[model samples]
Target: AQSVAQPEDQVNVAEGNPLTVKCTYSVSGNPYLFWYVQYPNRGLQFLLKYITGDNLVKGSYGFEAEFNKSQTSFHLKKPSALVSDSALYFCAVRDTKTGFQKLVFGTGTRLLVSP
Candidate 1:
């Protein structure tokens, strides 16, 4: 089965420091990977995706990810984090065979960025 695993339940970091939220996945054949962030009660905001291309893919809010096929990982990264960047992050994988774009998301990672 296609699945995404976010090992960390929460990540705390000082403001302006680099940040990372780990993610690992398993899928049959090829798959689409995505990252999204949610704030409070609001819906998830799309961050990035790795369809197929170079190992490194960039996204909004100065975030990026490196798709490592051998390791079956796609960890999110940011050079300089901000207090405002704090939120709940979810790593997901596209279940294409389902014939729907339904995304299987991780439990979630709470990003506690402190000033």
Candidate 2:
């Protein structure tokens, strides 16, 4: 089974300040990790992914995440946050052991950026 955990329910940040949303996962095989963001009443949009290569992966809207194998964590980061950056973020993991791609998503973390 594959699962993702987003420990924080909400994160508040000021505009121009850096922000981070944390996520951790568990999987049977090599994990395919992803982060997605959703605005109010909208569907999730892909942010970034960690399939292979560098530990740090950059994504859309100036978002990036660092994949830590030892800790089984993928924490999303933004160098500078904007008011528009406020949204609900989700962390997901694919279960390779099933031979089928089954994405398990975290509960989601709401980011609030104030001006």
Q: Estimate each model's TM-score.
A: 0.96, 0.97
- The model with the greatest lDDT is 2
Candidate 2 structure, TM-score to reference: 0.97
* lDDT of predicted model 2: 0.96
Error of 1 at 82 (Å): 0.2
Tens digit of per-residue lDDT, candidate 2, span 4-80: 99999999999999999999999877889999999999999999999999999999999999999999999999999
Residue 64 CA displacement from its true place in model 1, Å: 0.5
User: How well is each residue in 1-115 modelled by candidate 1, as lDDT tens digits?
Assistant: 7899999999999998999999999999896999999999999999999999888999999999989999999999999999999999999999977769999999899999999
Predictions in order: lDDT: 0.94, 0.96
> Cα deviation in Å at residue 99, candidate 1?
2.8
| TM-score, cand. 1 | 0.96
